[model samples]
Target chain A: MGRAIRQAPGRAPRTTRSLAHARFLLALTLAVVGLVLIVMLAVTIGPANVSLAQVSGSILGHLGLGATGTDSGAVPLLIDSIVWELRLPRVLTAAIVGAGLAVSGAVMQSVTRNPLADPYLLGLSSGASLGAVCVVILGVGFALPAAAFLGALAALFATLSIARVGGTITPARAVLAGLAIAQLAGAGTSFIIFWSAKGDSYREILNWLLGSVAGATWNSVIISGTALALVGTGVVLAATRLDAFAFGDTAAASLGINVNATRWALLGSVALLTGAMVAVSGAIGFVGLILPHLVRGLSGPSHRRLLPLVAVCGALFLVVADTLARTIFDPRELPVGIITAFIGVPVFIVLIKRKKSSAWS
Target chain B: MVVAVPGSTAGVVIENLSFSIDEQVILAGVSASVAAGTVTGLLGPNGAGKSTLLRLVGGLATPASGSVTLGGDEIGAMPRREAARRIALLEQNTAPSVDLSVEDVVLLGRIPHRTRLLGTFGGDDDRAVAAESLAAVGAGELVDRMWHTLSGGQQQRVQIARALAQRPSLLLLDEPTNHLDVSAQLSLLSQVGGLGTTAIMALHDLNLAAAFCDHILLLQDGKLVAAGTPAEVLVPEIIGEVYGVECDIIEHPRDGHPVIVFSAPRTAVAPMRAAASA
Candidate 1:
């Protein structure tokens, strides 16, 4: 009946616009490959002079894949221990933490409809730090990861309650509430450290606060890896629904999405993911904030494309950053968070300056 | 084919709907019915609850009391995805902070048709519908353009295209012509009028309502003050009583529809003469 409005001269014909999909697939493939290569390269670059071949041989031999004709006797046991025991766990833990934090950040940005939102914006990191520090100083019987997750959930509830006024959560109010909780949690963390921490334990708490993977073990790898698979996959699968939120709550609700429920679920998922990562990594900063922004430049704003790509890129970025943090100072080590910020700030500024136009105003 | 009549089971019926937030009522006991295959105008001044009524019908908000039925089915009882497949709402002043291409923005309308885990069960069909909707709204050429780059009218047109992509039977719009120029407004309304779907649009321009709407519902202070054909409801008394302004209604020579000409308020409150009585 409305055919009259369809008249236009020389209109472009609709072609199969599969190019974007092809590009996305290509990016995903590249990211997967890049992560593998970066992990391989990062494990080789540690203070122990493990060559690429020996590292591969050790990994293959451990996997029960026979080493490719390399002399097993030539590869020393200590180097194998350094590669397999020390560096590999740390690198894998960094990668998982990166992926989880990046996914959490992307989901947070989409749910809040705020471009600047990151995993830590809801006071997750500070709360987790508080939990971790309490366990460290007070010699609590509870596991640090469990305590940290609970603390993050507590902070989330507090932030949500404060932000929600008259049944609406404005972004400004949420950010403000998060800041308040973060500061409160940070003060508590500092107070616990000041009052109860003794000697080397204070150093331990300091390293945790600054976010180091120096003490990462196979346990950390298993914990962060499981969290990433369970919660991160859920967030990625929920990407389509997240796209509905681009316009705002009303439009999303009209599209048949239960906006409030979806928002709460997504928020809770992010909190869980971030809490798990923080429990393992002690609140590594900048990866959550910058990786999503950087990946968005390549994948555009579609979470379907952005989530997996950001996960991989974040993994690569953190693996590289952690490798540098441990090896750059030779005998001494720095917190990985310091390295991420040092590298991330410049890269972020460059990205901001390089873009002629932004998706957001 | 049996020609479906307007105001049939496919139409929308809102009965005694009331909504309040924080002890402030937004819509009160508003009852109205719109017929299928006709354009209905929701005419009201600012804060008159036109948007709220539309929201209730779109199933975005629940009425505190009473019910909304679409096609003889209670809307609140319908599954959200099922209801979305039938109805689309175009809201006012929605400037998304995200950067999305026009095509992607329109593709959002296909969400209701998509699976929960994986979106757009039929990708090719969804893309075609989005393209056709963009063309339907005269935004076909802007398909590749980023949303932030579009002008206000173009953005509005793209928003309409997004809504159209849903392939809805009942479309609700809030001030759909707020950003359009005069010519664009006329053409947009003409396009909507010819769509053959039941459309309930909240409008501020009384002349446009008179020209395009088959039925008019006038609201004042959350109450339905008048409802009928435009000729019956656009009378001066109802207009003045609701809008608090004096207005003259003239018949358009071309279409024989009522065109309102507004004037200053008939009663001007005089300043208190220096509290003379005190």
Candidate 2:
């Protein structure tokens, strides 16, 4: 019906169009290739010190291609176990969790219309920690990931209820309410840690709190992989709607969006995605906060171009960071969160100084 | 000018439209009709509910106890996407929270027309339409510029280009010339006149309304005070009654349209002020 309006005469020359999108696509393609390379390389960098050949041989052999393994003389059992059992699942978990957190962060920033927003800023991580603490320190019977998801959902409900008091939820009110819930959840987690945690068990609890994928198994990979595949795709497909919210609520409504429904759906999707990532990786920080902004610098703020690249960049970033976390201290490993923060703060500072005036409205 | 969509262009009819917020009435049973393919100016002082009335007509809000119909279809009953395809509203002083390119902002107008199930980005035809819309508004060269870097007048033009890209049969504008210079304002209003679609804009400038709009609807205290041609409705008495200001109307030298020159407030309040002092 509206095709005539689209067929206006003398179509504008294609060469006159902006090359920013072309540049963005090139960058996205490079990022995907870089991620694949890094994933293979990250698998080989450890105390075991395996080569790329061994890593590939182990992987292909496990996927039912036994010919490659026979060429390497049946691929030693120890190397195969390391590549398939320990390193592969941990690296995959890092990549999946990274993608999930980064997507959640991008969606959160757009939905809240705030540049500083991240998945963890809304109490999801603290709530998940509280859930994990209940099971670990207090001897609760629930599965750790399930408990964490429920706790994250509960925190989201609380934050929304507080924001909704006396009126509809504005972005400012929702952010403020999230801060309140984060603080409340943080205090509860601390109290439980101090009152009940005993001796060396405190170290384990601290490791989970600080965030790590060191304990990731095939089960962890399955949990986070499924979440990212489902919720992550849904969010990315709906990312275009996030652009409608760029101007304001009324403007989006005038653009034919059901503003309230779109906002709730996105926020809910982000919560589910963020909760799954946290359940698997124990609230890995900085990947969610820094990756989207870093990618946005390359892709501008159009969510369609910005999000897919952000997901890939995030996967590359965490895979590299987790590799450093395990190998940096030799036998004593550090949580991946520490490396991310160390990297994130400097990059974040540079971003703030460079784009301070132009990044925000 | 863009080709008008067949069968979608229709006049707006607001009948007994009333709306309130927290028990405070914003629009009180105001009724008005805008003929198809004609430019109408909505004029009133602050709190006169001109913007609210535009919102109702655009189907962004539903009336409390009455109806707004576009062509023969009730605006409130149409799907949001269908309503957006038929009506576009250019709001005043709205900017995106994130930095966006001028072309990206213009492409936003294509969202309602997206027919694919999971269309995450605009296609070739959409981009062509967006570029054409920008060219129509004299902003084709600004397609790559960042929105935040534009001057107020330039930004206003980009916003108009975005609205044009929507290809709506009916256009609603709230102070579309709000922050522009005199020449910019004149050129923008002229562009609006050239667009060939039905349009209703709320304007504070009487002379601009007289020069561009084919019809005038004067509002006062949530009610429509007058609805007619500028010569019929831009008389000094109606203007003074609605705006509480004294004004004179003269014929424009070139076009013979009403030229309203606003003067001081009316003298009705002098005796009341003297009695309060006593």
Candidate 3:
């Protein structure tokens, strides 16, 4: 019986398991390298046409590694200002926001057990937007991110309360509750905008609404970057617990996870991450909604291999998308949201039409 | 059969357990004990609270008024993780929405055994255990197949593999054979019978229960109607009263287990008046 068990018919050979593990590792390493390359290449592609070498030299020089060329003294002040002061922060912010949103989306989908669930599925983006618009329009002295984070927490509480029926939350109820909250928050934002806007403030609010990294500063980079690193690390560490949920709530509970508590904590953390990204970049779309599915197509549904890769790919995607958004329109400068929608909608359709069997039913 | 050694912790003992949802009592004061290493069939009709009773014993739900003890330890007082290490429950019709390979699904059984959050949960040892479990369920060859692609019987087999991977001392299954064919159902119960673990299985098939279960606990309307060896519990009178149908009980020629055969309802109505007029 032992020998028969060992030689069971459909079990993949030991070699295959190792090979799959190796494949995941290879994919992860490639994504990391790709992210680094994209970030490097993106910083060099803005309107001023800063050469790759100068971009590299300026980055190295800032790190106290000394400039690459002998004529370091002759480096133009304008190029330095453009590279260090303008483009680098914006690109970095875009990358971080992308990563944050994608990770949030992946976590949300797993928690809700819904394929269509995105980071904003719980009305997070709308809540954050409401907070931001209140700040921008009402001239509130509070920082926009603080207000946005609070708004997101409020919306999460409201959604949870609405979804909860006799102490259990079904996926359908949660989705419907989130949709209702999203619409309510959206209407609130629109009302605030309509009631208050006067002069150039309208342009500022519009820029925020459309989701642009055009105004990204060092502070924006710091805020989004820190949020991604902190919250992203937590999400990756919790991957195993999340994997236990693959079978459903009762199965996860049987596996020793406190299913309800884990779901609530994870949902809260995702909201925090999404709120931070939304506060910084003004509700960029698609990166969160589509990137996880794309990554799952390459790596299987194990969150252990899925989470980190999703984060990196998300960063790579946003950096590339933002680059296109700014460069494609030249001086006019389109918002990154518009660019993501154009690319996202077609890819989503193709994914649907391909009808390949995915982990998501 | 492994008999319960009086004071051993290997058996499950339930005392005066009651549970209700929204004023609808699902199980009321139900009590029974399953011996160590015996396959005890939970026989009941639909809405008879068999599933609810199994959940309470598995600690998936808390009883309203009584207690379940496993080996003398209060199951409700045990830490969920500790309880999980010793007990595994397989619910009916479980199909994960997420796409996962058969191996991955089986590996989920190892979660309670995993000690650290940061380390790899499914290591070589875990994979070996999972493979052994799949092999035990005759599903070893399906380790690479996607879960959604599998037929219902295949999925049930894989789910059994997942439960086996837990290596639980007490296994609870709720209508595990619902999607399986006759042979598959018999084979699965036979496999469980050989595992040397105390198993409580909720089953609708009286014959299958008679053939495989060492003992039978018959339930009706949230209460225990009968509990004993198959011959003692599966009488025609109890079957008639509980199922509202007439039935005959006979000894199986091969195994001497009680075999139940149902007859048509005794109170058949006369020919309809409308049909007579037409």
Candidate 4:
């Protein structure tokens, strides 16, 4: 089901085929290894003099797999707290957020048949931010995260409804509607935050708006992990329909796809993943937009190859970016969104300059 | 469960087939029949229901209170994919999507042959069949070329190859030669005509239709005004009545086929001027 179409010109070299397949597998494997190493380094490299061994043992012990700690007091407790309650979930949360966002982006791009279309481009993030803003600034919901999740979900629904006005959703129409609603949501959020400014509480708005995994804990990890598993399976199940649709709606229909059902099912799945991602990570932008394109470039735009490859690369991409955010300033941590945008902007510029955007269609 | 459709059958019959978009009445209750394994040509002016009737028979649209049937079964009664498996439709001016190679587009014709639960292309369904389809229309090398990068004629041939790949019992084409040059157009229609599959093609040029088609269907303002061999349907009186033009049609010397020659419209009102002179 996951086979990449073997296509090459002239007398296709056997070595070239094996090499390309080998390269894809190697890249994914190395990325996983690199992510694991970075997660360990990230756990131990802060102000505390925690060694690699200490972090590993703490993790192993927490998992009921390592040697017990020698120190019986606050030292062992602090180690357990940092490794278990803090760094572990933060790293896991970044990976999960990356996977969910990337998968949804790939799905959305294929469904919309527009390369620039990302899951959050439909106002999922801004909606979530609006939800968080009303709670954080106006004291709307004392539980800010839950409020942000609901707000994000609402925004996704609103954008989808506006785009689907005539019982048909075109690529240009959907994007236009999404942009309009996103601006409105942004304005509403700014109005609430600006009018109700009290002291330096603007910093709270910054954290949520800019996106941070600073809030990640074991609980968020569990919930986000479950959501990704359920939704990822759904995406893979719809893989053939996506492949058929890559040809366009008419072709897909001739192939016997119920265009309406497939569209709604895909819309619901991507919206859920986008909402869940924003709810957990407060909208770490750019990875969703750029990662799928990069993967598609490497492996041609077949969804069978594109979806899983995009997921792994997305997970690896976010974990590395978040690690840099934590380690770049060392003592003072920057938000992961800042790092993602900083990386995303130049790559996006290069993508724009590349004259084959028409090729994406 | 590969359940068969209730009314799936083996031959097509079009009765009073007509279609109009935005009230323009492209096809006016045109009726025709294409027997199994025979290649037929649909010939008419630019806006004729040639394509419209083809679409009707292909089940792309339902007729305006008319019936299109396969064997004894109405086309509207069969399930869509099962119906698609029976008839392959190649519409004109279809653009190839980005990054999809020619092989990918050709392989799409095998979609109906797929088992939905396990949607994998099997070993028996690989390069051999694709190569055979490509070879049928002399596109054996283009099986690897990117679809978006092909020339207009090459792309048309590739699409024909795709329809051939479907191995559909009934192949329906709508002006499959719109932008093609002379040789490409001839070889395409000629090859398809000899492919041993039942083919119904809408063609603009009466000469090519006359040369290659077993039977010709002539349409005018959506009416099935004429249907016969191309030589019979392409007479001067019928062509003039349908197109409002004076023309001389002569049989070709080498191949001995009927050829149509269009004369320019008269700027002078000859009938009124003759009356004034008198």
- Cα RMSDs of all predictions? 4.6, 4.4, 4.3, 6.1
Compute the interface RMSD for candidate 4.
Answer: 10.5
Model 2, position A206, has a per-residue lDDT of: 54
| lDDT: worst 10-residue window of model 2 chain B | B1-10
True contacts kept of each: 0.55, 0.45, 0.53, 0.12
lDDT of 3: 0.81
- On DockQ, the stronger of 3 and 4 is 3
Better of 3 and 4 by lDDT: 3
Which pairs clash inside model 3? A9-B141, A10-B140, A10-B141, A11-B140, A11-B141, A359-B99, B9-B71
Candidate 4: give the clashing pairs.
A361-B98, B11-B71, B28-B222
lDDT of 2 by residue, A318-350 (tens): 999999999889888899988987987786568
Ranked by DockQ from best down, the candidates are: 1, 3, 2, 4
Q: Which order, best to worst by lDDT? A: 3, 1, 2, 4
Among the numbered candidates, top DockQ falls to 1
Evaluated on CA atoms against the true complex, candidate 1 attains a DockQ of: 0.44
CA lDDT, candidate 3, residue A138 = 88
lDDT of 3 by residue, A1-361 (tens): 3424444454346777778878889999999999888888998897787887778778877777755334545347678778899999999999999999989889987877765566565677778878877886787887877777777778878887998898766656775787798788877887788787666655555555557888899999988888888888888888988888877888888888888889988988887887778788886766777899899976778887889889889999999999998888787778898888787777656754554333223
lDDT of 2 by residue, B1-278 (tens): 44332334679888999999889999898888889989999999998999999998888887888999888789999999888888989889666334888888988888888752357466798887887778667767778788888987888878877887778889999999998899889878877777778899999998999999999998888988899999999997787677777777878999999898766454656754443322
- Off by more than 4 A, model 2: A1-13, A16-22, A67-72, A135-143, A157-177, A199-201, A347-361, B1-8, B96-98, B266-278
Q: Please give, for residues A137-244, the per-residue lDDT of candidate 4 as tens digits.
A: 677644655665677668767877887755666555666776787778777776777788677556555555567887898877876787788888888877767877
Stretch of 10 with least lDDT, candidate 4 chain A: A1-10
Off by over 4 Å in 4: A1-20, A49-52, A68-75, A131-177, A192-201, A207-209, A355-361, B1-10, B16-30, B43-55, B62-64, B71-73, B121-124, B219-223, B266-278
